[model samples]
Target chain A: MTESPQGQAPSGAAADVPVAFQDPSYLAAVVDLLGAIAYGEMSAFERLAEDAKMSPTLADKAELARMASTEFGHFEGLRQRLADLGADPFEAMAPFEKPFDAFHARTAPSDWLEGLVKAYVGDGLAADFYREIAAFLDAGTRDLIIESLADAGQSQFVVDRVRGAIEDDHRVGGRLALWGRRLMGEALSQAQRVAAERDALSALLSGGVDRPGMDLAAIGRLFTRLTENHSARMEKLGLAA
Target chain B: MTESPQGQAPSGAAADVPVAFQDPSYLAAVVDLLGAIAYGEMSAFERLAEDAKMSPTLADKAELARMASTEFGHFEGLRQRLADLGADPFEAMAPFEKPFDAFHARTAPSDWLEGLVKAYVGDGLAADFYREIAAFLDAGTRDLIIESLADAGQSQFVVDRVRGAIEDDHRVGGRLALWGRRLMGEALSQAQRVAAERDALSALLSGGVDRPGMDLAAIGRLFTRLTENHSARMEKLGLAA
Candidate 1:
């Protein structure tokens, strides 16, 4: 499996040129990826806020609110970067709204614990997918993609809350485990739709001869890694993934 | 005609021991006031995000999202201050949840223009009311309240959007004017309910002998100021007050 370049390229891939973004197509592809990520952030902000309403306590509500705000921060960062690249952030973001919105609408959590699991499991899968895609990009763009994912640091709070809930009622673990699997299914269908529609993003994963591209097998392994990570996250929450 | 203290104290008041919060009741009152403001921020974030959905364009949605995030930021600041004062931030914010939630529920905007008007008119009224009440506090608390209000900055986008829409369709102006009034009415009803229910908050405004406070006439004058500001905001947005 070819690892997405990230900052760890084989000796000197990005070293030849300042970055892979010099090519207009590469630049546009990067922009498309960033735009998708930015829209994802906006969706997270709105979805998390709606979920916050289901919060059982003020403390719980505050946590979800903080998560929403953090997602907004990432969106802003991505938006600014898109602008810096001479792209209209709104137009850049427009194409991905449907798939993202559909994903959210279909996977809307039924309760607070489910919301937590959705956020944790869903975000984990998306981040892993992006991280894999990040490997085929220039260091700078990959770094930005990775950094945006990093801000969601330590899901320990979500882990504790989800685990604690299941501990209180073992039956919850069974329900939530099913919920996690459904979230993963919805996410994969959405991602597949997005991949079919977004040619540039697909190109990012399967790069050209001049770029660090993933072969068909590597792409399969990327999906494998994403699924594995998702299961690990659910297991962390004591859910059978 | 009175300037909200902000950081200024009269010749003798807030002088004896530096501030009135030395008294336990005053301390509780200040904490209560901060809690209300913090929870107000939380409500604003949720309400603004909901309103953002009614945005006619992605740009407009981004503007409202920025406002929502700013409100969340203010909430975080106030929550931190509550913690610094040895108050449980969530508990301190608990008392305010009902009133703020009621205000939001009763004033949820039906569309983009109405949302803008609500954000403009409703927030303007609330800010004015709080600014007036801030006059009865110590400089530090007063400054914090004032700063939290300040981050809202000028709602120039709302003003421009509403005014532009009204210019395009004059009927919108009349409808929004009514909305402005309805918002003011709902806000005042909620305010009165909160004031009647929260004795500490009421006491904060009508200070005890040791602290600077407003007389009945002064309180009436404060309402006058609030009404005037609300009218001014509506007018700025090209709506009738």
Candidate 2:
């Protein structure tokens, strides 16, 4: 859960992709990771737009639209990175479509409050997991991941709106609390399935000959950290994890 | 319609909010105009996002997402300008919402191709109308309208896709040509409703004593230009006017 002890001092944006990408598996894994993140961003954008449509007020709609635009901005970067890596961004995203779609289908929020909770909890969990993976990548890729995962100032808005709704009706809080839990569960199920299927990506965690990677214990700790963060986010929304 | 014959030389970004705004009605009209455009941008963003969800391919979805994001970007600029003009952006948008919403509700696309044609013809018509109004405004607000209405480059993609679909099935062209006409009809109806309801906005055309405004003849010419432009856009999309 801690920063990779083997982490080198920041390289500060290397001129080219680091030499580590010369390894075919490392290259494949990085491509897979970026593709997954990019697709998730696109999905996030679409979901936020849907939420905007369902928003009760113009201000709320504008807020969601801004967040959606921010997600698309990040997606554009990841997409360009995929192309620079000589992978067709769409092709790279292809393998991820089913799992992400399935996850969204299974966890589609029923209303505005549910959508806000999912956006908060689901995005936090994904960001945490990706940040953990970023620890093991080369400097350039790591920097890109950090930038791509930057929050678009939606957390406080979600927290304010959700907590306000709960204040108006306590029953709303209980239902949303349950919704948060379901989001967490569905997200984990899909993520685990992706990890199981993507060997190159999973291998990025298990150390190679020269690169440092997480051990089993470290992987366990990483999940623990992710869970803790998810719980913290839920609590922030005044919902139980 | 031809350019304003009495047009002043471009003042090139006036400071002190232009003397013309000293007129209370002019200020209200400018605010009304900006509010209408801003609300339209937000509406366009939501609609494109909807179309994106209905798109058949990831590439198509990404394209629509990009357009949605672009609309939101313009919305942000207009929102800030409204605030700068001492109008609560949301309050300013309120008066225009019903008409814009009604426009969207009446013309909602039944499928992806219908969505594309609407985007193409609908946006082109709206942009043309706003640009015409821009001609009668102070330089600063005029520049903002011009910038906000700039096309997000969806024209070629929409034209290509819609035309390709038509090429695949001759029936599609006929259906979409009719769709284009409906979009034009619905848009003009909504716009006219808004103009009638918002007196100051309409007054912008019938001049103040010192400032030039369009005569009935000029108003006739303006509609002619808008219709001609709409037909031209449809023709470009391989659809009949």
Candidate 3:
């Protein structure tokens, strides 16, 4: 991957760019990907903090605050990494602002339960998609992406609360199942829009000269995996995908 | 400070309590103080995140998010400390929730500039009050309070932005000056209510047998100091106190 067709190391990439990301297109894609993740984390932080205000108990509020803080911490790391790569973090994140904002606006949870479902289901789907893309990146960038997506292990409480609520009344499950499907739809639509708009990010999946890229079949399989995981998550939460 | 009038260490203090905080009253006051600070930090986090949405520039939004994250980090620390002291952090925090909520509701900023002023002035005032109370606590608790109150140094951007707006329009200065005063008024009223209701917390100001407590004159001086600091912060923001 380090040597191109000329049998020499590629040199046009930024001095700080890793050998694996020496391709300008590859570097651009990584930046775009990081930018999206950073902004996603920031948006998640905002939404989670907002949901915290609706918590039924102080303990639940603190838990949500902890989750928000964790996401913000991930954002700080990505911001610093962008600066280290000589990309303006905010500029990197700018292109992603609209789609993310739209997604949040469209899926604004009506209450605390819906918020938990969104956090769990939405984050689960995004994490799955990012993990799929991480397969094509340099180890360093991939590690950062995976670390940023690490579950804070607060999901159990989300699952517990959500499942407990559904058990109290079968009708609650029916309503949340619809909410889960809505979140999945909105998420997929936003993901599609992001893919259509970010050429470099999309190109990351199509192999360049030195990298192994996924074919259309693999891309289909990736989506299948993402959908399957989302379903599994919804099932765990006593909701339907 | 470690010994009582009987020339012995106080008993019935929690086993984990520090020697200087073994006076149950002092311990309760310290717990109350920590709880108030924790809840205050949590509310600040929410307000700052809310303000980030109103930020005119993406850069400004990121800055406010950074400040909000820092406040949440402080809240986490105070929460853990409360638990370590054998206090249910949430229960300890319960008493102060109403006043803090009322303060935020009453002083909700009308615009981005107003939010900036409130963050600067309100946080500055709260930090000052906590620092004053810190004086009556044990070394351990005092250090914890001081650490939690440590500024994240994001205030310079707030100062620059507010002052720049005032420079561009003198009318902004007049309006913000009034906003700053309103914030101070709302904060003071809420704080007085907290003081009036939380007996142990209020007693923290009245030095005990083992510790140097503030007399009424000293108490008056503390408020004077707080008001002076608030005015100074307002002046720094190019506003009237």
Candidate 4:
């Protein structure tokens, strides 16, 4: 990952570049998007650590706790990366705090497996979105995003565990599949709410005259990839579409 | 701390070896004692992570989560150490799990300050006890015990925050002081119960053969030291003894 050169636009910069960074609207929109995602990561870490207690045995408990700790590492990475971009991590994240928080509060997991499902579904989408955005950033910012992406290790563990549980208990598949769908719905709904309010960010996704090839179709492609991965994960867990 | 020499008389060894380890009658008692402590640490970690949400900001939340993570690290260390001693950490910690769980389950902190007070008081006692016991063990076990002591970085932060709160509202001090007292009472009561049930452990504490140098006096000294430190902390926070 390389940081974008300051002042100098890329040879094939997106047409929307003038609107994405130079325009106040675009900067605010980008900040809003980054802020919401950063806050979500922070809250997710908290939830994972708390949910770890639901493990049935000491070994499971230890593993879950370790997994949860990785969230903080991810949170820190995101925060520092945001700081590198000249944004206060808190300020960038503050606006979406309430909505993201309410989402989790309303859907708190009832058990260990449910928590794992939340991690798998929620973090999977977050990582996908982040990876897409990282594609447009400068070297330093791209590197940070890539580093932050590594924080999803524990989420992968959760996916494996949830899949194993479903395999072992075929009856659980229906309920968990429904749970996964709900998680995605809530996540996408919240994301749409964020995108609706941040036009500059939407512009960044749509790429501009500077970069003729960028557009909402790219965003659509990103979402398609995320849903595909999510569907495969559900099937691997013995859950239906 | 060095390992006790093989074939040495148990009486000649340091008073730290719970007689239950050598005496069948004392095994259950020792296991129950260690298990309760282990479980207590586990529960505390979970509660602390949950409480981290009350932090006024994301950075604060991260700090609290990091602190909570340390508890899990300690839990793992203790678990591994127990396993090395041929005891299952979960099994050894299981007999009193209900009571210990009930204590924490009932006393869950409602706010950041309350949580900090719990950490400040609870961790103080644990560190005190571990420090004293370390003196009685062989070099390796003692070093392991010392190394497993939970770091006070998070607790100190909590203490600072709690103290800052008390400075703004004197009444806050009274409530926290009372909470601290109750926490200590429950902890001491549980300790006594475990002690009474395990005579070899009791004997190990009481010293090899007689009462003066036994575990009780050591416990008493530990309590004194803990209370002294607690008093200083309370004074710093403007809380009444």
Candidate 5:
């Protein structure tokens, strides 16, 4: 059977919600956006846990576990928000699952350092994109999105580990650069897939009845900023962007 | 090289702590006990995250992830305590790796239900044993241990899942009963191994110069209580003890 279109509201206690969300499409779009972030957090948690498996030291493992726990923490916040918005959080998260799962499966890190780079670069990009989207959202949701995007100082941890590994062996730098680029590419591809499939999300991005949003040119600038930040992150790790 | 005995205080800031913890041996033992629980929490995090993979639905997966996050939360608290006591948390947890990993391996669940049962039953048993050991500890350490063992209401989730499964198919209850028994047995074996290997921990339990501890009868009763609790838990899942 063909999959249901994204942002089609799942039946639940959505009727009594606020005026802002009363428009069914706005509610669906918000649910879709929140769902995507929720799935992203869960996937991040799973990937981070998997990454810990390859940690060379117990300290490193603990670091990865800490990141995993923090991602799960954000996940709870998003899931609750989805419920408060009157969507069943799980059903809300369902549409984006295939894309996120596929991204992780394709980019499964072969070793510890690569896993660290992916954790940092990939999540950094996702956070950037979400922050941009938050600009077009309501104050409450935008704040929640921004709050959930807090990296908890994890980027520095990844930078230190990755840079330390590169210093230990200069040759490691070249391989990880490729790994970082691939992470960006795969992440973008999956994200594009999500954008194409999720009409409500696209509508939210383009502009809604009352909410202001990014124009095509504005979005292009946003992409430029995202790419620039990704490069800057790679540079921080002593790698070529 | 022979593995260092569990609870051997590594040399460091342990030099000038509290008067009680200043007894290097007592310090090592407490660090060791905290380390054991810390490693147990990490292992539990890993195991719960693994169990989440088999979740039949996104909601179930989130429930497992929430539990995993809570375990890591406890782990962070214990690790901080270890550092406060002047031990590198990793080195402290190192001695426990083999036993906890082995216990998890032996009791690895064959399916989702088995994993849930292991999570609820195995962790319940470990918490009971730790609480028993906590009775012999200093107030600070004892309080930390008790705090770390908080179940976060996970029992009801597991019980609901397991009981619902049993109701769906009676045969499931019989198999889960055996799984629960295996989890209990493996847990006891690992706990015995830890006791035999950690001299300071054993000394702590048996009573040191100033510390009052479990007499042989008290130890026997502790075992009786742990077993009774396990039986009660199994009964709650609609399985035989």
Candidate 6:
């Protein structure tokens, strides 16, 4: 339920503090997480931009595609932060190749609405998790994280469209609600897979001096918060909870 | 060769004016071009960002990946401009999908150097063309085109790396140069396909107004300029003429 303290140095005099970057295990975990998120941002932007072409009108199309642009900004910030911490962004992202790839493959959207739903649900959880951990980071890194999670511009548009569709044709909301649920399920499944397989990252999450006291229970609680937000978002859009 | 007029208006006294939004036919052609370019930008960013991981150090990785970020910004500008012109970005892009897709498919990079070489040659020509077209466009649309072409940040980085690699290993340049040549050839072939198929776009290139004293030879010269730029760029990077 608590934020990961991986971003902090061990408590001591400044000179005597054990820098997390100096610890190979810690660096590896952080790098892995950063890479996963960075690539996620990259792929997310590409797909969203591509799907924007599917919009029925120019205004909606531009609005939808512009949302993807924000992802690139986020990707750049994460990439630079990773580099600042002595990690290669691409290499750091490589270990995430399989799980994230699988997650996207399994949840490939079949329509524009599905794509929007994925962006809404997937990016929402990511921003939430990043926002929490960002609280524990240095001012610069935390600032970057917060800035990256700022409004995606299309959120209101997405809500309006979804709500309008629900109002005009009640049957559509049920399908999209199911789609939203599946997206979350795949995301959580991938999160667990990554945590279980990457021990350095697992240790950073569960065993670090800075991250002490965090456990699977915390992750579960995080997911609970994410689902609560997702439900609220759906209700706001006139979709079934 | 000659600069393509921005976009033709639908009808009325303002018919000759170069508006950002054109008739559906002209809008379709512009979107076709922009879509192909946008998709190219998206894919290039993904590939180059991934390639940056192959770098030996964090600084190098960040530097390389940062180049990819520039393309995202260009993509955003083009998408927005498409919207301003009342063109559904995706629909405008859909018609040219096959050729563009085929070009990238046949020329997928086999390594980091290969990837860089493609960007260096491929984007160099694209920038050149966009620069020429900017002259014929209305101020607002022209400004967007010029801004988009101002810097191929990532492409230049790739060129720098490619040049360095050639310097380090003389033998590598020859092979990369060949790859560069092939990429340009494919690109030109695709360009011809687009020109031949999209009449409004071709008409735009031929000079839309049919002015009494219009110089068609000037258009031929424009193509010459693009070719010359491409050759100079390739030679600078140690690619064959």
Give each model's whole-structure lDDT. 0.83, 0.88, 0.86, 0.68, 0.87, 0.69
Tens digits of per-residue lDDT, candidate 4, A1-241, equal 3666676555432333444466554456556656766777777767777777778776577676776766666677677656755678888888778778778886788988887777766776777777777676544555655666674533556657877887788877788888989888887887787667766666666766664336567667888888998787676556775
After superposition, candidate 1 runs with Cα above 4 Å error: A1-19, A151-154, B1-20, B151-153
Query: For candidate 4, what's the TM-score of chain A, rounded to 2 decimals?
Result: 0.80
Task: Order the candidate numbers by lDDT, best to worst.
Answer: 2, 5, 3, 1, 6, 4
Candidate 2: residue A160 lDDT (0-100): 97
Better of 2 and 4 by TM-score: 2
Ten contiguous residues minimizing lDDT sum, candidate 3 chain B: B8-17
Off by over 4 Å in 2: A1-14, B1-14
Tens digits of per-residue lDDT, candidate 3, B38-141, equal: 99998898899888889998778878888888998899989988897889999999998899999999988888998888888888888899998887666667
**Candidate 5 vs candidate 6, lDDT winner:** 5
Candidate 6 CAPRI level? incorrect
The segments of candidate 6 whose C-alpha lies over 4 angstroms from its true place after superposition are: A1-33, A46-65, A135-140, A151-154, A164-170, A198-212, A215-220, B1-69, B78-118, B135-143, B160-214
Q: What RMSD value applies to candidate 4?
A: 7.1
Q: Which stretches of candidate 5 lie over 4 Å from their true place?
A: A1-19, A209-211, B1-17
Candidates in order, interface RMSD in Å = 0.8, 0.4, 1.2, 1.7, 0.7, 5.8
> Mind sharing the TM-score for model 3?
0.91
**Interface RMS for model 5:** 0.7
Q: Candidates' DockQ values? A: 0.54, 0.78, 0.56, 0.45, 0.66, 0.12
lDDT of 1 by residue, B1-241 (tens): 4785676655432343344456888888878988999998888888888888877888888888888889889888888878867789988888888888888888878888888888777777777777888877777777778878874625888888888998899999999999989988988898898889899889988888777778899989888888888888888998878
True lDDT of residue B178, candidate 4: 90
lDDT of 2 at B14: 40
| lDDT per residue (tens digit) for residues A1-241 in model 5 | 4654475454433323454676788778889999999999999998898889889988888899889988999999999889887689989999999999999999999999989988888878989999988887666788888989898424688888888888999999999999999999999899899999999999999987677877889889998999999999889889999
Per model, the share of native interface contacts recovered reads: 0.57, 1.00, 0.57, 0.65, 0.78, 0.09
lDDT of 1 by residue, A1-241 (tens): 6785564664533343334557888888888999999999888988988999999998888888888888888888888878867799999999999999999989888899999988888777878888888877767677778878864523788999988998899999999999989999998999899889989888878887677788889888888888888888888888899
TM-score of each: 0.91, 0.92, 0.91, 0.80, 0.91, 0.68
On DockQ, the stronger of 3 and 6 is 3
